[model samples]
Target: MHPKLVEFLAGCRDEAPLQLGVLPFGMICGIASLAAGMPAWLAQLASAIVFSGAAQLVIVQMLAVGSGAAPIGLTAGLLGVRHVLYSVSLADYVRHLPRRWRLLLAYLLTDEAYAIAILRYQAQTAAVHQSVPGTPPGNTAPGATGDAEGSPVRDLRHWYFFGCGLTLWLTWQVSTAIGIVFGATIPADWDIDFAVPLTFIALLTLLIRERANQAAAAVAALGALLLAALPYNLGLVGAIILGLMAGALSTRLARRTRLAREASQ
Candidate 1:
């Protein structure tokens, strides 16, 4: 098999397990769309464009209550503001790709995709860092970014990202269709709501092993509690901003502390 294909397959394989959480989220979006009086076709189309489960859910609820276009647009845009940060962080990894490829990958980039893909991209950077300890970031690390002397991982990373994104995309579409058709028939006793948090908590715990992550998580939690009264789900958006800021600050502080220790030595 081609190495790129292998990387793609590995991404698909790794992402498959996480669909346990994604499937229900998609289904609920479909179900809720139906309950909100959205025609099946439009609901499915909305699913394709919106893509993000939480954002889709908020949009559906807004549509249900007859919210105006402006508020809905503002709310959805705010909800997705975090993706800008995700893209900025990921730009270093994919900057060398052609524009078409970058656009396609950005479309595929979601919270789930970002969570999984960023880890893989960072691992590639770490490999380079280990190979040349003390090399600075940015231009120095473009090797994983397809410089003439780029690492194989950098050259083939898009394949893995494509694999992960494609799998999630397909799974979501299929699950949405199922919900549109049979969502009303699902038993309430099944209590699928628990899976929502359970799945994310698992993802969260896995990512929160570091102090920076823990600090960020704590601040986000506190922000959510304090800001829960905000309208149009602004609380959630505020919490995300708080979390990202906390994480970035903590990461910078840790790096500075490490450099200071090394300088002292």
Candidate 2:
């Protein structure tokens, strides 16, 4: 096998465990999509096209409730705002790739894929930085360009990202197909919709390692609750915007504090 293929397979292996969590969410999304009176084909198509569990769930819920197109579009768009951050974080790692490759990877990018890819990128970056004699610890900058040149690991990072994304894409499509086919058989009392929020909660738990993230999340939750009565579910959009602002502010404050401490020292 080519070295890239080997690295890709390794990436797939690394991502396999996370797919267990993703599978049920994809299935639940399909179930909800169909339950909302959407055709089975469209449900599966949305999985293939949108490829976003949270956004898909929002689309289904809005459709089920007979929401207007503007609200549904706004809700889904708001739910997907996080992907912009993911793309920004991933840009440095993938910037060397061709435009077509970058576009395809962008399409394949998801919460699970981004999480795994970032960890791999950071690990490889740290390894490279440590192997060099002059590099200090904790100095692995996001846009470190030297990591990619003549570095097999850097070359493989894209393949690894592709492998993780492909595995997730396949898992989502297959699980969604099964759900679409068997949706009618599911018990109405089961309330499989709970899986959507649970999946997000699990993702959030993994992501909120920093104090700024926690603060932003708390503020966002409060904002959402306070604005819950807004018409056409616009509160969802408001909460998302408020969350971004809060997170950005918290991060800025933390950075400034760290800089001040460094100056004092």
Candidate 3:
């Protein structure tokens, strides 16, 4: 097999678990969207255009509960606010792309794609950083310690991310259409509600490993519970704000403590 094909296949294998984890959620979103009176094509379009499973789920749920356009749109938009952060992180890798490509990429920037791409990008960056030349004669900062020639190869990683994202995108659209077409035939005994939270727990487990992250997540959970009764799931928005504040404050405090310790030394 060609080297690029091997690399691509490896990436697909590596991301299989995540793909499996997201497919059910995507299918649920399709069912919920169709159940909520959203057009099947609309669900597919949202999945294709927005391409974020969480945001699409929120939009469908809100619509199902009879939310007006403003609140429903706001909820979807807010859930997707994380994309701004994703764009910032992925910018370095995609910066040289054409204007149209950038716009298309921004539209396609889902969480899973961002996660996989960032991991690959970071690895490539570290490799490059370690290969820099012209270190000072006496400097000892692990200067130029990675493979500089490897930076451009990061672009190859984008193909894997794109393949994963596109596959999920197609799955979401098709699953949603099936639900719209046959929702009445499906039994209502399937407890998808339980599954959603379990999915979230798995995703959170993958992302949160540090004490600060744990604290931030705890605070967010507390805030969400406290505001659970708020109308139109505004509680979720509030929880996100509080979580951001908590995380930022925690980081600031950690930085200050480090500064103080350095000063004392």
Candidate 4:
């Protein structure tokens, strides 16, 4: 097998484990959509179009409760605000790719895909940094770029991203289809919708390694609970904004403190 194919397959294999969480969430989104009175076809269509479990659930719930179009749209848009940060962060690595590939990647860019891709990119970057002439071995920092000689890794990066994204897209679609088909059969007492928050919590646990991230998450959770009475689920949007602000401020302060300490030393 070609080396590129091997990388692609490895990417798929690496992403396989995440499906354990994703599949159930996808199915729950589908089931919840139907349970909330969304038509079968439209529910499936939202799965394809929105491809966001959280956003889809919010949409379905709002629609079921007869929410106005503006609120529904606003809620979905607010839920997806994080994607803007993902796109900006990923833009540099994929900037050299063709426009069509960029467009497709943008469409397929999900939380799982971003997590895997960014980790891979950072690893590759660290390797490249370690290889630099003046840099001591094993002393590479984040955000370092590999040399032009590392072109092969760079080339394979896109294929690996494609494999991961495609796997997620297929898994999500199939799982959602299953849910739509058998949703009515699943007992309401089962409360499959719980899987959605469980999946996010799992993802959040993985991401909260830094103190800033931990602080942000704490603030977001508290804010959401306190503001739960907000009309049209606007509390979610508010919580997200507060989380971002807290995270950003804490991160900046940490960076500044580190820099000042270094200067003093």
lDDT of each: 0.83, 0.79, 0.66, 0.80
Backbone clashes, candidate 4: 0
lDDT of 4 at 194: 68
Q: For each candidate, what TM-score against the reference?
A: 0.89, 0.81, 0.77, 0.85
Relative to the true structure, candidate 3 reaches a TM of: 0.77
Q: In model 2, where is the ten-residue run with the lowest total lDDT?
A: 137-146
For lDDT, candidate 3 versus 4, the one ahead is: 4
Residue range 1-265, candidate 4, lDDT tens digits = 7656776786788788788888878888888888898888998888999988778888988988998999899889988998998888787677777899999989889988888877777676667666774543223333222466653223557677788888999999999998999866878798666666776787787778889989899999999999999966778889988988999999999999999999999
Q: Any runs in candidate 4 off by more than 4 Å, and if so which?
A: 133-154
State the weakest 10-residue window (summed lDDT) of model 1: 136-145
Candidate 3 deviant stretches above 4 angstroms: 1-10, 61-67, 123-155
What are the RMSDs of all candidates, in order? Answer: 3.2, 4.1, 5.2, 4.0
Candidate 2 lDDT, 71-96, residue by residue in tens: 78877887788789899878777777
Q: Order the candidates by TM-score, highest first — what do you get?
A: 1, 4, 2, 3
Name the lDDT value of residue 33 in candidate 2: 87
Query: Model 4 TM-score?
Result: 0.85
Q: Give per-residue lDDT, candidate 4, residue 94.
A: 79
> On residues 56-143, what C-alpha lDDT tens digit does candidate 3 reach at each position?
7777777777778997777888877778867876776667557886786676677666666566556556665577554322221221
The stretch of ten residues in a row with the least summed lDDT in candidate 4 is 136-145
- The residue-level lDDT of candidate 4 at 204 comes to 82
